[model samples]
Target: MSLFQNLKSELIRKPNSGKHLPFVDGLRFLAIVPVIFQHANERLFKYGNLPELKGWEEQVSFLISRGTIGVFIFFAISGFILSLPFSRENSKLNYKTYLKRRWQRIEPPFIFWMTCCALILLVMQAYPIGELLWHYLATVTYTHQLFYQEYSIINPVAWSLEVEIQFYLLAPFFAFAYFQVRSLAKRRSLLIAGIFGWILLQHGMGWHLQPWKATLLGQLPHFLVGVLAADLYQKPVKWIRDFRFWDLVFSLLLLTLAYTWTEELGKTFLFELSLLGLLLSAIYGRYTSRILSLSWISIIGGMCYTLYLMHLPLLEGYYSFIARFGQWSGYIGQLSISLIIVLPIIFLCSVIAFRWIEQPFMKKKDQKSLRSNPIGKQVLSKA
Candidate 1:
């Protein structure tokens, strides 16, 4: 195939595939870009030697500080996607197969990039081999967040993945339980109760837990929001599905409230609600935002996992190189230079990683069946 055709194939979804949601991919892009902006802004402030912004610029900076919001959106997307399989009527879920697929989808790229980061640390003599070995072990096992107060020595982003893995372990049970409820109203009530309960627990009891926000308990509400969205998507109501301008209006209103809220619980709750509005608008609204649903945007969203994992390291490395080779300019000039040089590099690296490292390990139906029934299938074949 020609390059254009190949790119098209990758970007465009095959219609009626329940597994593929282009709008969700677009949502991923939205979530990840803010994260990139957050890191970029930090690097610019640290290394750019720019004069501090006094007025509007400072306000803009504060807005970008909301980059962690991307992580919340990601958790919601995870909940929605994972629960989707279980929410369908009469769906058969084999735990062994489900876990195997989850591992295959997540582990390979994570391990690959993590090992690369560790090797870089070794080469730079950043730590003793003995210490580095322990760090690597802790990181790969997703235990670094529990044991250490700081971000992972290998990759700070891995902290979120630890939370994600915890949810992965619990999601099957949650999905199964959700399906057992017969009445939709009761199900909605339970979801609402769970959301509020988690909020209360996080605010009330979380003080006793160090680094509470990073733990699964504190983040459970965000994932639960996604589960609710999944439920809506699976059995969509016409009122939600029919596109309306009010959906966007309500979403923006919630987002504004989230931004204004001083308390963590309030901010998180509002932000999650805003994300739900956006998700609903994208999925059901008659007039979906073209920017969000565009092919290129969705493709970027598809590569978000790889981009998120690698961007910080790449930023650090680029900053180090520029520091050695160049002199600092004003903020605008520095930011412009960094954007011109770094953004393309990040995009290129992300594309390569997505194509080779991440994509290869994604669960294909044939591979999944083989993995799930390896010995049984082999014996049958022999017979």
Candidate 2:
């Protein structure tokens, strides 16, 4: 490759490290970008001098807030990706290797960043070094919820990561019956029952905060939806085929319904159903799938773990630098500034982290690469 080609290749995305799926990474890109903006919008409001929303801007802000659905998107993707090995016939599941790979893939970047965060806080005297160290240890263990009964004092985002760990540990068993059973109707009926079963259990007993939202049980349906998507993607039904533009349009409608339900219909199994339809439509739609599978979009999606780990801290830490110019437009203007200015910085910094901190831990192949029953990823009230 020539010089420009070399740099471009390196900059665009890393190498394949496993069984690759281009559109899924594209799906991740679609999911994560909104999450970055969601935080940027929140920061511009809470910490910046942006003027109040006028007219339809309030509606826009409401839409932006819903971007945290990226968290659940990640959950679904994790379910889809991790379930892949088991979803294949005659595929053997090795318990130890599966456990080890999950640890190796995500743990280092998380630990490095959290350590950096803890050291930064200690150096700044935000907390006593001893106390900070104690919290740091708790955060890495994915037990900060139990230790603090709150979001990690170290890194708030680590909460969802804990649920990722839980899902990682549990995914094999969840995926087994779905793929193992030869009878589609029998397996799918059971899957549907399991999803609503969790919902009904929550509805009947009432939900609790503290540790409950931080665990995998809180968001199990979304992950199950991903598993369902994997099943359908692998063994698609007779009528379930591509419709190109129509499929994309249908996905948009499903997304809109899913978005509006963010508040009132938030915890129901119905929400996961919408997400399922969205995933299937996006995948089976020929044009939508092609667009999602494009080199650039999928590559960015491929690096989402680094983005998720770093974006919030970067926004929170650096907002003051940009907040000075926050009064320019209304909410739209502040948001525009973030999209134009802040997002690039987040990406640039994250690319470095992806190249060094994350890629080193990736499988030898450099390819690409949530919560509820997991942490909801609502911006933390405090450390």
Candidate 3:
């Protein structure tokens, strides 16, 4: 069979959207795998280990820069997913339930992971219990970035978690802003104009730390694209479903040219636009013919959150322990061995955490409250 035929067959195998969107789960698979590869062997790719004209020792200088694109993909995916439920027919989507659901979904696993990290440090006598607890508090509250340069923050992967939490907190306000504009056509036009304007504004302003901080003009467009994708999904524009591959191919070529020039900001813009097109293509099932849908990849994608949270610290610990071997073959051998050891460990840890910890807390209906002064349902319901 042709590759497209194989891809179509695999996509058809997935259960339809009584659950989540299958193609999106597949998209998550794509995003998370790149992240893992980037984290694990980005150094190798940097030094030109993979197939190319360059020698291994003279690896490209800008390979780590691709990690920024991975992060943008993540932000865009999130903005789309988070906006999905709110854009539907249910005008009175209860904010309290939304908040509670988000809390239950996020807090338990995070707290568990942070506490586990603290306990490990304490037992190793690397830190006093008091200092560990403070670190734990900062991480649990998603303020780790604010204290990152100072405290013994456990999971640096969590910088994105801080962003995700901020998105969640501001979701209601964002929704309010969207709905306040009564005209749908005008709202969409405004969104289109805003997307272009934000990119230009960032370019005009240059790459100062201040725009990065505001994130409104910098990261907001990616997030807004995702939000707009969600809106489009609920009430799709028919022509979007007919989006031609040649258009995306042209976009991809433009993206490659930008990357080749080492234009970081231009790459971000091109990459985000390409990702947006791909996401729309996936949603409309236009590119269903191109998916591999590997069972192993889907399984790992399911555990991506856990792997994302744990991989860095786990890899660091592994690196420290491996340095004792002293006389290693080379970077390739070291990276391959490290990946072989780490992938299985990351998978196992994520599966166990998802089953034993994350699942119960994220039940559709809230269960019995665990705390004496649980953040009351009323506030949570507004979420």
Deviation in angstroms for 148 in model 1? 1.1
Please provide, for model 3 over 1-383, each residue's C-alpha lDDT reduced to its tens digit, 9 standing for 90 to 100. Answer: 99856644432312211243445556666666656656666534433234332365335324433444555666777777666655654344455656767776678788888777777777888877787777778778877656654333565566667767777777656755675566767877887787767777777776324325423334667677887777777777777766666334533643453363233666556655666676676665443524524555554555456666776666656656666656355555656676788778766766666666765554445345422112223223211
Error of 1 at 345 (Å): 0.7
The TM-score, computed over Cα atoms with residue i paired to residue i, of candidate 3 is 0.75
Residues 297-345 of candidate 2 have per-residue lDDT tens digits of 8767878888988898888877767776546666776677567877788
Error of 1 at 14 (Å): 7.5
Could you say which candidate leads in TM-score? 1
Off by over 4 Å in 2: 2-4, 11-18, 208-211, 242-246, 250-254, 257-267, 324-328, 365-383
Model 1 stretches with alpha carbons more than 4 Å out: 10-18, 207-210, 250-262, 324-329, 363-383
Whole-model lDDT, candidate 2?
A: 0.71
- Give the candidate number with the greatest lDDT: 1
User: Candidate 2, after superposition: displacement of residue 86 in Å?
Assistant: 1.3
The CA lDDT at 14 in model 3 is 28
- lDDT values for all models: 0.74, 0.71, 0.59
